[model samples]
Target: MATTASSAVTASLTSVTLEVADPDAAHRFYSAFGVDTRIHLRASETPSSGFRGFALALTVSGPATVDAFVDAAVAAGATVLKPAAKSMWGYGGVVQAPDGTIWKVATSAKKDNGPATREIDETVLLLGVADVKATKEFYVGQGLTVARSFGGKYTEFAAGPSSPVKLALYKHRGLAKDLGVAADGSGSHRIALGGTGSAFTDPDGFVWEA
Candidate 1:
């Protein structure tokens, strides 16, 4: 029910960051998703921020559509962490970005909508937070519009219905566990999100840049 208000404290998402070893190669790979995102370059030998802690969700037409897009992503230099499959929520697959970020391309429900074009549709950068309800409340206070949400579990926020990239938060341990990694440990998540603030850190330590 929260909406972006007029106050300056209202933080709006601008771009999300992808930390990669090679910016150029990462650019080429992510270009397949058809979204322009920010990239932060790191040493080539630097290790990945293990467990992903977050995921980029691509909402498409249906199951087959998800498969086709997942295929495209694999062809674009991604590693198939999980193959396309169906779940109660819908059908989706997990892929590790060339830079080691996890992504989930899926549909909300079942249908025979076929495949999508070369370009992907709406993308949601989901952050795995320690507490979804508190994180949701924090962002709501920061002036983001909560397009849809459920307390203590998940939150989806955007500028509007057609907004291309939305910022969301899910229960962190659940997310890491879902991605097949242990839900404990600390490391720079290697992701950045643009928002209006004095550059605050979330409950789970995800940093938002002003």
Candidate 2:
């Protein structure tokens, strides 16, 4: 029996929501992060009673970390909802972006020994190739910008105005050997760069952006 499209789509699932503290500031910050800041606001003003404080909530690592994040957000034009401090749950306090989004950054009390899921906050795509130099040059020629490099084995590329999209290049043979799939110059993967660009494999078994 042929597989249904819904089943296939369900097999490949990912979810992410962008929350901001101040609507205007959040829009600006996200725009700099390479996201198009054109989403229509559902609502903005604080409700008379329900869900007071902060527009959006973010789960942070801890109080200090949340504080640092708040500082960065403020520097990036976000407004503070509450200062980072100790939470009643022994974690950290919450932060509000200018858009009224709340970020809850806290430390996990116990380690999770379960399925590993991708972080929605950031998504990185890996591309395998034999020659890193040539791959980098190809992207540079195609109007993309190179940001950083992990030695000659790998290089990072810019996907946004402030954020970066990683185009990791591992040894083609190493990747092929590791993935148990031979490099046939036809296999493919899709990387949604949050509006920056998508990466795909080329006929020469190299990855390119579109």
Candidate 3:
């Protein structure tokens, strides 16, 4: 008798691609900002304005690391949307990259346990969708497992061992408020997700590919 080998059937986010007007410049900025290894870049003149309906986040170990990232980003030409500070949950700040991508550097630790380092614990892609419940269902159909969910307000997907980025969902207006930006946005999302399945677009128009 012959037996067939089987593998776990699951969808995971393998990569993230950002479409920018100038790949070279974007490359420079990301490299200097110390996250070039986390994202891929492509050249495009896609007209985008306002919030872009998404934000990339870096989870670090402590407040010092968060400050280091924010300072590096600003030095690399990113504009400070919110200066680093301590909040009830943690210390964090928001910055807009030179290519117009919103980035949030944060940590749940209120203070540093050790010396500051450029190490990033996790990279998260937060999509601000119209309906969290519907979008969560869409990703579920694509085989993504829910790691966490909060009613119709937010949802988080479990990342596979090899996945480079984690995925999450948030209400459009709530996310905009958290990022201190306007909720209204139009044109391309300027971002893409690489998955382990066939290419498709999500309910909120987030493009994903195998």
Best candidate according to lDDT: 3
Q: What's each prediction's TM-score?
A: 0.82, 0.33, 0.95
Candidate 2, position 114, lDDT: 45
Candidate 3, clashing residue pairs?
none
Cα lDDT tens digits for candidate 1, 1-210: 433333332456776776667778887776775544433444444454457578877887777778777887889988887888888888888888777788888887676655555445677788888778888888777678676677677777755433356787888888776666666655667777766556777777677887
Clashing pairs in 1: 10-142, 11-142
Candidate-wise lDDT, in order: 0.71, 0.40, 0.91
Residue-wise C-alpha lDDT for candidate 3, range 115-177, written one tens digit per residue: 999999999999999999899889888988788788788888888888778999999999999
lDDT of model 2 at position 195: 27
lDDT of predicted model 1 = 0.71
**What 10-residue stretch in candidate 3 is worst by lDDT?**
1-10
Answer with 2 or 3, whichever has the higher lDDT: 3
Off by over 4 Å in 1: 1-10, 36-48, 160-163
